[model samples]
Target: MTTLSDQDRARIAAAITEAEKSTSAEIICVVTRSSSDYWAAPFLWATLVALVWPWPLISITNLTASTIYLTQLVVYAVVALALSFPSSRRMSLTPSWIRRRRARLSAREHFFTQGLHRTVNRSGVLLFVSAAERYAEIMADDSVSVKIGESAWRPILDALRGALARNQLADGVVDAITACGAILAKELPPRENDRNELPDKVIVI
Candidate 1:
């Protein structure tokens, strides 16, 4: 799993504080090791191998049915163990589309789960990253999108994607938060007596 050090977390938190100074939109950053466990990949591989292993033995040898069944169980166990050793390999076995879909779902889940929708002006933004899946998304509430349009987020997404490709998550998130703040500040600006409706911190899960 990938993680940021204490200094990295502090840096991100400070960036959020600085960005929110000019905009009413509440910005939140979230980083996670993966979107899902993807247990199906290993299980599928083991099942396929075990199913085929007994067929060949049945055709060539006179092994008893019970013995062949036991061997099949052993084969499944061995293959599962082999695939389980390194988590990276296990993730690779999963189809790319599945991983991306799961990551997208998780990002949406976090947007609501973190109370981004509960803000007073409906001006919350979430920057989400799933390191293992190499996925990132920027979600904004209806108020911001209605004023500035979702296309405004394209540049931020591109910057973040490049950073992730180079394995620089902390820098990417900081830059993204700054960019979001600028856009929000221009369109929404801070209301008179606007108070923070959400905590300014980096959330890891």
Candidate 2:
């Protein structure tokens, strides 16, 4: 994954707000790097617990050494089975002969934010970052991407990256994007009568 500095992410968020079709910020969903941590955290934490707790138990049992060995054997088998099986909470992005796996990697819908291309499908979202003449993509299977537009996103992302430089990702960046960009509540319906304006002039402010 491309590690974006906090300053860079904030700028993308700001640019997103600027690109909103409406002058008044109108958006209902905002997904960011923090969102991935939430989903991956459980698996990460569970691994920690499993590692720390098992050694003491195994060591203590070794002195007395009885059915405890058999018990450990059973526990290990179950863990191995669970890891091999398909589950929603698995925190996986691996390809498999399943609908979810195929859908995430090959999503058809696409959008651009802060010169980054975002593609979405039923399985997951793909973020393609454009830096001058080069490009990179970050893949997350647990996310959904909605392309607002490049103009609104650029400012928002820039501000977010600034927040990162100050070590304010959780505090400043998320709040700024969610509150100023209005990504939690439902936004106004698209106006059928609204006119199209050129992208360059839309975010001049």
Candidate 3:
């Protein structure tokens, strides 16, 4: 997984500051290592490989039943152990729907955990990215959603995904935050008493 350097964090913070200048809506950015551990995938794959271990021996040599069972066990152990590493564990073999679902769920959880839903005007927006899954989600509170339709976020999300594909995560986030801020500025102009309810720092989880 790509960890954010201090410079990346600083850039995101500055972007948030610039974006929030004209908007009452608060923007919260969060990046997580992964959306889900996907432990079952590695185990399932390992088991499948183990199940086939006896096939070749059965076709060629007359190996004892116990020997075949032992070989299968060894195969399972080796495969499972090999996949235990974090990077190997989160392989792309997982279904896309599963990854997307988990990311969306995570985004919703952060929406509350980060206090985006608690803003006075309900105009908070969350820009959530899960690095392991290469997923990005934009969630808006009721007040903001009521004014701006979901389609409006597509352009910003597309730009973020583009940047992510190039390994420019920090830039992508900054661009997305800036785009979100523009929408909020137009729809939920700044209030004289508006305060920074959420931290501007990019949260790493």
The candidate scoring highest on TM-score is: 1
For candidate 2, the lDDT comes to: 0.36
- Kindly indicate the candidate among 2 and 3 with the higher lDDT: 3
TM-score, cand. 3 vs. native: 0.92
RMSD of 2: 13.7
- Clashing residue pair totals per candidate (backbone < 3 A): 0, 33, 0
Q: Which residue pairs clash within candidate 1?
A: none
lDDT of each candidate versus the true structure: 0.89, 0.36, 0.88
lDDT of 1 by residue, 112-169 (tens): 9999999988999998999888788888899887888768888888888888888898
Number of backbone clashes in candidate 1: 0
Sort by TM-score, top down from the best: 1, 3, 2
Candidate 2's residue-wise lDDT over 9-119, tens digit each? 556555445534443223222222211212333444445445555567776655444555555556655554555434334434222333332232222222223211221
Query: In model 1, which range of ten residues has the least summed lDDT?
Result: 1-10
Q: What is the lDDT of candidate 1?
A: 0.89
Q: In lDDT terms, which candidate is top?
A: 1
The C-alpha stretches of model 2 lying farther than 4 A from their native spots are 21-25, 32-205
Q: Estimate each model's TM-score.
A: 0.92, 0.25, 0.92
Ranking according to lDDT, highest score first: 1, 3, 2
